[model samples]
Target chain A: MNRTFRNMLLTLCTISLMAGLSWADTLKVGVQAPITGSYANEGQGIENGVRLLASQINAAGGVLGKQIEVIPCDDQGTAMAAAICAKDLVNKGVSMVIGSYTSTCAQAAQKTYFNAGVIQTSDGTADSLTENGYWTFLRNSFPNSAEGEFAANYMVNVKKYKRIVVLSDFSTYADGLGNATEAAIKKLGGNVVSRDKIKADSQNFTPVLTNVKSKNPDVIFFAGYYSDGGQLRAQQMALGIKADFIGGDANDNPDFIKLAGSAAEGAFIINVPSPDVLPYPIAKSFIADYQKTYGEMPPSIWGLMNIDGMRAIIHAMEQNKSFDTKKAVDYLHNLQTPIDGITGPIAFAKDGNRKGGAYVVKKIQADGTYFNEYVQ
Target chain B: MDIFLQQLANGLTIGSMFALVALGYTMVYGVMKLINFAHGDMVAASAFVGLTIYTQIMGQAASLAAVIVIFLLTAAVMACIGIILERVAYRPLREAPRLSAVVSALGASLVIQNGIMLIWGPRMKIFPELVPQVYWDFGGVVISLIQVIILALSLFLMVSLYLFVEKTRMGAAIRASSIDQDAARLMGINVNSIIMIIFIIGSSLGAVGGLFIGLYYRGITFNMGWQYGLYAFIAAIIGGIGNIPGAMLGGMLLGLFNAFIAGYISSTWADAFTFILLILILIVRPTGLLGERVAEKV
Candidate 1:
């Protein structure tokens, strides 16, 4: 061949390679999390779980023959930031999104993602989240109402606590759970002696605990994050309030045990089946792999749920052979078989909240670790 | 009555932490006449230093000696940080416009908070429980060993601070410099060294408060500086801005008020009530409870 012809051939080859590099048909999944603020731990934990699952899916020959790319958008754990993150992700043309540790953030992002016709799933469990009539939004976590009802029944039926004090951090999520729990307890003929709302960053729980002590409640139900819950437990012990402290999903973190220390003993937390307790080989191996990869157990069950939620989304995409938002939404909403999640079997209701998601009432044992008392 | 007693005890416990942190704010304001916004971040930084020493360096064998060692190490290290912060972030801006110095303090606050976030990865850490679990029961009102220690230590430090400010030569220099920097310098007082000494004392006190909070709550987040810092600033303002005794008084009063409101009214309204009180106080007496209206008071 002539020198000019040879050079042209080389240029053509380079063009093809560049085309393959630039337009490789990768599926982009946006991960929205508060990765730079006080709630960064929870958001980071969720991102880790999703990233790990994405790697696993890619290793298994990718989803729908396309390489999975998980892009994280830090929302700083604020509703405003979350909305901006949602808009940015939609602008980036991501196929799907996993997000938002708090319900308020999820709700904030819902309008943006819904308007853009992008699929988004959250671990936040606020009941009204699914009621927003957004086809694009789904929650893999169970509702706050469910968890609250479960907790109330446990307190009234199992422990037979007649007088209870319900306390929340006054966030939408915490207040919803606290209200539901109080209503449930009252419905079951249990007296809600007092109800109080505390600030999310409250350092002192003495006044609230003192008031509860005066009420002589048999149990104190706290609906808030581990920071508040753990400190509340410690302060309650300090103030000689012997009432057992029970809390919602936010209590399902290692930080709670660490902060509460000896006070965490006998405290009950409503949680999903942690990966360690999942009887499935898939879950057991996931836990083992997580430990090997991350050097610790998953921080909370929400981490495992994020993995399963992403898995379900990917499975739906594979079944439909399309990244079209409407198709994926329909597939997820009509998921006939439950996805075998690391936590447990996860199915979705028509409203997009997780259906048949098993909750477990776990007690913090004397060994400073949680043990599943019973599955609900 | 039992509830009132319990709330009071709780208020005092939290009040001691506020007073300790308020001393840092007031002292810096007294000497430099500049609000050190980074004062609260120093608490967080010191707590993390103490936490690192206790958990990573000292390991599981931490005892009373370990606690004391960690406390001293944190205080010393944070004092050094205060010196460096003053030298790098504040001293150059010292001769600049007063607003520039204030802006620099705010910038320093952001840098410290975000720097901590970068180092610690924005995760909340559980401080090692150094104080043993023991409670003194008074019928329905109980107090823990940690609370007692916090109260006693704060009282000792406040008393020492009072005596040092009133009696010591360094304290005299600090007071003189606060009155007139040029006059103090002309009087053979090394104003720069006195300023550094003030930073040292303030930073150490802030560290002690931070360490106590970490032990009491057993949780520390990087941004905790802002929360505690805001409260300390409020207390300082309420007690009469740069007045040391006023800061102590403001801290106790604020704590008691917070506890009472939360106990009697609503915990959700506690913070709102606090701000309302601040607004009311400002409206009623802009000079604060102990602040002087005349310029010669400084």
Candidate 2:
């Protein structure tokens, strides 16, 4: 009786092993990020999100009833490395690509993906990306230009600042953000005392900070990634400069708190609305299901968008009921299905932009990051 | 005026970092006939070791004493690594062709840097700010307490180093090795040990550089050493390769040059100016300010 039971267990194990091997040949989604360099913290979320989403999709009977495989590439968070990932992905035969943690990197990869006729979804929303118009290229993340306008409006209209200062990294994204924000501030009857671009890796902005302090600007809008943002925040507060730090999405990370410590307590930053998953049952269910399967809520906005990007592609494939690239693009262009996504009310506009219902204001709080409901 | 003073202070603070890192480069080149390309990354590795102690085993409340203990432990470990690199990777090729030795050092550098990334991770973490930044003014110039301390410490270290090399027997033997390796070896000196000693001392200097970088920047990415390392190398070259005082001059000059460019020249041209200065200097003085053309013996 014991020998017979052991033989039966061995037979069951072989069958499961066979199933695992076949799982290797499932649908592949290539994910890219700056996993090898200075921007790795930011990149970590973007890469992990692709896998998190892929697992979710695969669990739902897979895409086209086939399991999903997430293939990730490291771009080291640099532009040049991102381009290489694009080329490498195309050769690897991934149908669509999700990538690029920074605008600089997205800019480089967009060209490569477009030329290769491969599809791409990016989190970095540099304005120059709009000109490409690759039907295959789509950015779910709002551009920094929009962020700039929103930040400026909030400072002048809500805070009622008389004079504002602008400090931007010389990145294409930050510069566009700074320029648009500067215009917004002036339109609101606010004067710009100082506008300067600091080096991306600059350790100190005391020169710029001091000048602004001397001018006594009511508020300062800093446009840069979290690395520089945190340092500037710490130094500004440490030196007794009282200007409020207003920045865009790059400041949306826990690392900012780690760098600035107590100095970051009252700092303000602008970001698109993450669906208030707590209050809304639909969004809460999505988060619950995600955590049950993957063990954590999507850490950053990129996780939800990446999952949404995969769903968009999979939804398109189901509509056409095939793996054709053009068919997928057509489905994305005319996405009409009221898919209940984790981010709420998923639908695309004519120009491939997420509908206005999306973009919400989030505030960093002591307990957890909070988002204000959009009152449109 | 407040902004100008602040920027000036910022420049000096960063200059202090360059000075510390520059010492490692200057000293190694001064004592050995080779540049330890791995010095900067060794600093990075030590910081990671320090960080591992803080966030992992020790927990958040790791005391000031614990932090210092970890730092010294890391420094000692890094010293051993530096000595080993000199012994195994470098000493074998010391008598070989110059190009081969330089290439070997470069290869060692790449290995050490990438090895750290593989072992730890590539993600940037917020390093604990070990010291607080406060301010004082001298002659109407704003200076942060941290910056003043950094400057003062660097000056003290450099002076002590100068005195040791001028007065001590080991320092004299190290100097003699650089001047004439064969002569020192024949003079009943352990030439290899002196070279190892130079590396250990230089690596400790790099550890100091790394600690300062962690505190001042308050964030450390895996690749933090590359750009800073390159800049220090440029400072070393500009000061006159293998010259101690020259490295100091180069670091100060580079810092002042960058601050002036950002302040006076268009801020957009700040990055372009550094390269332009390097190119112009290269054209004018290929061997740098105080470098001498040494004849080779076949």
Candidate 3:
């Protein structure tokens, strides 16, 4: 009996050794997202998109002749958790990371990835994300400055509304977007009556709305995530506020309509083309493939954008014919040809911010569908 | 003037909910002298439970009968949970150090909060509108039908609780146990039963508050308890930790203070102003406005 037990132990040791050896031949990609917190839906969508892409690449003979292994770390949509996840992923020896849907999380993990010389890409649109000259970090989505300009133009030129009220929560992303939009509005000689800040998840905005109501603004622009955005819209409608409600990029989620109920109708949301509205054939096919694998469509355009980031990084690596992050980073910085992405032609500027942002002003229809009212 | 009236109406609507939640804290602290830190999470859990029951019973059209049934069923289920929490977390530490029970209460709060998050999947659930959206404009101060219903129901509950605690034979026993547990036991009153009764009343009131919030706010999340619970805790303290009427007054004052601060000043400073007010009150009154200076029993 003792001899048999010893033999079993020896077999387990050999199996584990073989497993460890095979891991060395695989390309490890880390995903840092808010997998289980207030932003769980977006975080889970990013994880699903990256994992699906990894499996597809593996099935097609992998990247750099190595099987792709995806490692996911849940940042829970907080800066502290994102920093911890950055350390964890770095310790796990990941060559690249595609993740962290929110800008604050991405910014928190930015320095860590830069120090470790790991290529990191995310859908966070906060303007400060790429401002620090982090060679290791690339923004998958357009910065808030771009969207802010588009929103200002739409409000000033297209819709021609006066007395705009810019509202935002205390998050780094929302507050920055609010500032950008407010500044852009002023630049265009548009009248911004009030710039208000709200405590996120307070579930009570009546006081602020009451104050805004007195201003008699024609437009109320809320730059916050869908969680608070929907509530703000619903409450605004309930209070009989006559202003036209326009939500910023972060408010473009199905849950927003769900939370807003019937009040969602006639509300406008400004963002890049939604996942279903993308005109690219590759976008359509990848979305179809994602739906087939995950049994649900991608949560929003953010997830597909992150997947595009992953595809861009892999394309750069294939062009350089190497897994060295430094070479891939250099290739990505000055790509002679833009890579076709699920969003659009993916290209990065010298500052690591995505180049050429296209935005649309989509109004919510009675049936809870978004109608593209104007495009820029 | 119209804006002032509207702000006042908003303050009262929010204060009604705070007052309801504050009662649970005051009642539990009154009996055991142990603050049930789990009270806020209990309110959140009850709201989720209420949501489930509400969805099941609510048809294409909502009825007054169905709404009452939802409230009662949620309260009953939450009362059972409160009893279980007391048994598992507090009862064991009853004879232990007071700080141990407080720590245990905090632990229970975490467990319930995380459990709700796991069950509900961290997404905010929208509460179905049970009443028709009818707004009554009072010379620019618009009041929704739902807001009126909330105020009326909360007032009813608070009055019922006050009467039950002041006028009934069980009320006397409860007061006795709270004042001196050993004396009450020697007087042939079952102190354990009184404690159990306190949990039931406190949990039920909190459950109703949960329902009211879900109906009023229309958006509920797993960790929502911490925010509302903290406000309600402050409300309880401001009113006097062991007094019922104190909670009601405290909640209203805090609500008014918050509304005025957010309106006249800035929303960013409202929370900071609330904390400052709390600190000032603590320094000035110490025992709270309604709290009496009771000598420690030898």
Candidate 4:
């Protein structure tokens, strides 16, 4: 009776092991984002978008004849937390990572993903993110330099602002954009009256605004996140500074309107075409499905851009019929035809930066809706 | 000259809030020789509680009467929390080593900060406009109505606290306990009750600071306590850790330093310059500007 029981247990164990092996055949995609922190709205949007796209792909047919498994890690919008998330995700055996709303978090986790041979696609726009020449790193969004050039041309040529004051928080992305814009303005012979830095989330920009007002600036360009951007606009108005307020790409968030309140009106935000404004059918359908699923629009263009990055990576994998990182990177770098992305045609430069820049300057109307003023 | 005046006005507005928060640190340290690291988080939590009361209970009412009512209710709730925190986190460890209590305080700080983050969902909440946007421009120096009210309210609270601590019988008990807990206890004073009272006053004052910040800045986050708390802590130390009036002076001085430094020098160097000045002050006056030098008891 004992021998018979042992044989029966062995047989059951073997069958369960086989079932586990079949279940484990699925591909793992990691999402590293600030799912909970000051930038929680943006992080949550990215997570939601990635999940929505993954589900749609799975519904049609699993990737490579296997289901796509999503493993999400919340970086808390901090560099330290992002480093830990990167390690955690890599240890989970993910082949690719779609993540990190902020440039600081993305840059923090960049090396870890590279060392582990995992492909990482981020919406972080810092120019330095691609400067390291990390093959594993791909930027879904255009670099700060691209936006800077566009902003400089518009401010100098189109608007013809005489005294422009540049403001930024002490974050990697904001500082980079601020410097880039400042340099671009100087290059175009535009007078940058003052360059100032504000402590992010300090909740008070009056001191800085007052100082800027003293300079008699014609326009004030703030290169910072929406959290600070919105407050800056509100305080700028409170201080009765009549200068035109322009916000960088990071200011393209719904909360900017809510936080700035009525001050959001007449403020201008420069960013890549917002998700809702994308003319691509793929973008529209994806947005509709996302809205149907999440019951709200994606927080900003960053979420959709991240989704497009994921789509492009998966498409490259499908083209090559391989899950290898090296093969996918090569395919993405030298595409015969650019994959149709929600934001635009998805292509990458040699240094992993996104090819082409299509930024739009949108004016915040009185009703808290964006009016596309100019597209470049 | 206009910029200087405007910067000064801005300095005073921020300094008042810092002074209010510094009072909490000073009071708690005065009575119990322990630095309540969690005091800042308490302020943040109170602001959130105030937000809830304003939105849910008050139905987003913007009347001055409703604002005052909300402030009182929020203070009361924070006082209760303060009492509970003292009992659970500090009371048992009171007999332990000083470092142990400090560690416990740090732990409490983390617990409260994370607890708030978990509860509030870690997003920056926009504080609705409690006061109408009205600016008073004095020859290029703009001062808003809310700024005036904040200055008035902060000054009123600080003066009231000063009077209470100086004149009231319970205030006498608190001062006595701070001077010598054992002696005060022997003198028929309930030291435990005195400590509880100190927590109540400190927490309530910090709560008001939180509300003031929320109303003024219009942005409240879960971890904002760390930054604001650090500034207030520095203020308390600069004024002399256990000195109430010193905290006030320190806060105002710090605020002025920040504004002037940012206006005249560089905004990025304001914090760095402040720290250097703090070091200079400590080297010159070990007990702070107003801190009385008391010989250590053997």
| RMSD per model, one decimal | 4.5, 6.5, 2.9, 3.4
Backbone steric clashes in candidate 2, count = 3
Tens digit of lDDT per residue, candidate 2, span B98-147? 88988998898888888888888786767775665566655445566667
Q: What is the clash count of model 4?
A: 0
Q: After superposition, how far is residue B253 of candidate 1 from its true place, in Å?
A: 1.4
- Please give, for residues B206-266, the per-residue lDDT of candidate 1 as tens digits: 9999999899988888989999999999999999888899899888888899999999998
* TM-score between candidate 4 and the true structure: 0.95
- Indicate the DockQ of the complex predicted as candidate 2: 0.41
Q: Residues B118-176, candidate 4: write the lDDT tens digits.
A: 88878788888888888998888899998899889889988898899899998899899
Residue A44's lDDT within candidate 3 is 89
Best by DockQ: 1
DockQ scores for all predicted structures: 0.70, 0.41, 0.63, 0.60
Off by over 4 Å in 2: A1-25, A274-282, A285-297, A357-376, B1-4, B56-59, B62-67, B133-142, B282-286, B290-298
Q: Is candidate 1 or candidate 3 better by lDDT?
A: 3
Instruction: Supply candidate 1's per-residue lDDT for A238.
Output: 85
In model 2, what lDDT does residue A211 have? 60
Candidate 3 C-alpha lDDT tens digits along A1-376 = 9999999999999988976875678899999999876687798899999999999999999987999889999998899999999999998889999988999999999999999999999999889998899999988999999999999999988889989999999887999999999999999999999999998878889999998999999999999999888889988988889999999999998889987887889999999999998999999999999999989889899999999999999999988899999889888889878999999999888888888888999999999999999988
